[model samples]
Target: MKALSTALTLAMLAGLAGCVGQSGSAASAWYDGRDAIPPRGDRIYICHAFGCALKTPVDFAGRDIAALRRILAEGRGSPAAERRAIAKAVQWQERRVGKIVGSDKDVGGLDMQNAGVPGQMDCIDEASNTTSLLLVAEARGLLRHHRVESPVARGFFLDGRYPHATAVVRETASGTAFAVDSWPEANGVEPHIKPLAAWFNDYPS
Candidate 1:
């Protein structure tokens, strides 16, 4: 189910970006650890993307994705490391989820369907928003692979432009975060970020 969701979300994203109809079948995963990666310091911070700018108290420079990958991989090696690993994962997820609005009003009624479903044509922003959430859930370990929003997304819409849904997972101490995804053309993990508060708010107990 998760993998299917991820594929659908990506397909929607490709469609939105005008890549769905392209001839080249390049299989690109969400995070390639290529570029645009956040910092990997001991105390990691997740920033939110807002209105043509990346917003957050956290500073992201002198950080490397490889280091973060090592930390998360090593951290996941033990039960004692779960909290920290989860925290890092949540932070990572937030970086992507925050860019998208998850309120019921942001995307409701016809606007959401028009934006979400595939058709003769569509816009990139809508598909980008949809894929961002699923990728975050995948990064946070909520889902094994990537996933897509069901045709019927029951809860929450953004400020009347986009419809949003969340990936459900078992309760964890790390809490949930809202992830934001940057366009693929931008390159690397730098395109993602999430806010701590918004993340948990998006996923209720």
Candidate 2:
């Protein structure tokens, strides 16, 4: 039933404004019509309650930037090392933003039980938020080996898979995109970062 709910939630959301999931330009159209990404290290919008039904503004102050810089510096040597550091950076971001929005208590994945509630994040929410955080790191010049790309989605309900989305990063050297997915885990835990190709066909099994 939970799986059904997840598919329903995603399908229902995609129907709104005829917006598809967060992939390419579609992500902007879905979230508050935010067609343009804000300046780096600026105030960010947190998407929760599924389909970005709730958007809360959160600022990344100097302290947060400092922490991000320090964390990302650890991965400057190699793309592999940077990805590990990216996970740490994302974990920190989840904790930081969660405290302000009370999303620290949010359950992971598609949670109809917390629908319209204060702190539930489906894959869409997770994808958007993680993308925003990654942009901040990129803007602050904290990212060295990988360039943050637009968020992407996979699956279609008719294909026997639930629609899902995730943030992405591209390795500058190899041009390989990796999925940064947070919806499968609890808040503050690092998302599963995997090759985007693998993520698209076989995830959330």
Candidate 3:
């Protein structure tokens, strides 16, 4: 199944490349125009503008969910712990997805090649994937202190900075929203988890 998915991804990428070119705007639009594909039971699909990787999708059954739960366990009752768990879970997903898509060495931040590379992900990809992961965690009741929210975006005309987007989680007690931004970090690294206010003021580092 994994082999078949890989073949399909390669084929779709070949076709999409011609339509989207290497422009980041085109790539971003291509991603935004697509509907969010939800997880089917224990399986979740990871999307790239070039094509969706893991045709069979990643299965979150049994050990996978257990691993996630173990990560979440580290933060059990506190928002800070939940944030750490969120970061760890996201990094785990990044590593798994990167391996499946063969983009394990992808660098962080704005890279021109990301617009064209099959496995390299842009901010849209990161935000979408993170939201999906958070949603999955929520469904499994692994999150106690934080609840996943819709992906939030800022910048471009709104902030005079480059367009950026991230997944958000709201603390149940304080109702404070924190941005879980994975695009500015290298693959498999912990993402920037900060208050939405601070995240808005942040420049890429």
Candidate 3 wrong stretches, greater than 4 Å: 1-33, 49-56, 157-159
What lDDT, from 0 to 1, does candidate 2 have? 0.77
Against the hidden reference, what TM-scores do the models get?
Answer: 0.24, 0.84, 0.78
Residue 40, candidate 1: Cα error in Å is 20
lDDT score for residue 66 of model 3: 90
Candidate 3 structure quality by residue, lDDT tens digits, 1-205:
9888567555534433322222221123333444446565667767664224322267766888898889988999688988998999999888877877655877788785657576777776677678778777888888999877766556543234655677778898997888899988888999989998898788642
Model 3 weakest lDDT span, ten residues long: 18-27
Q: How much does each candidate deviate from the true structure in C-alpha RMSD? A: 14.0, 4.2, 10.3
- Give a tens-digit lDDT track for model 1, residues 90-165: 3454343334322112322134343332221111232233343333334444442223321112222222223232
Off by over 4 Å in 1: 1-63, 78-84, 92-164, 167-205
Minimum summed lDDT over a 10-residue window in model 1 is located at: 25-34
CA lDDT scores, all candidates in order: 0.31, 0.77, 0.70
- State in Å the error of residue 162, model 3: 1.1
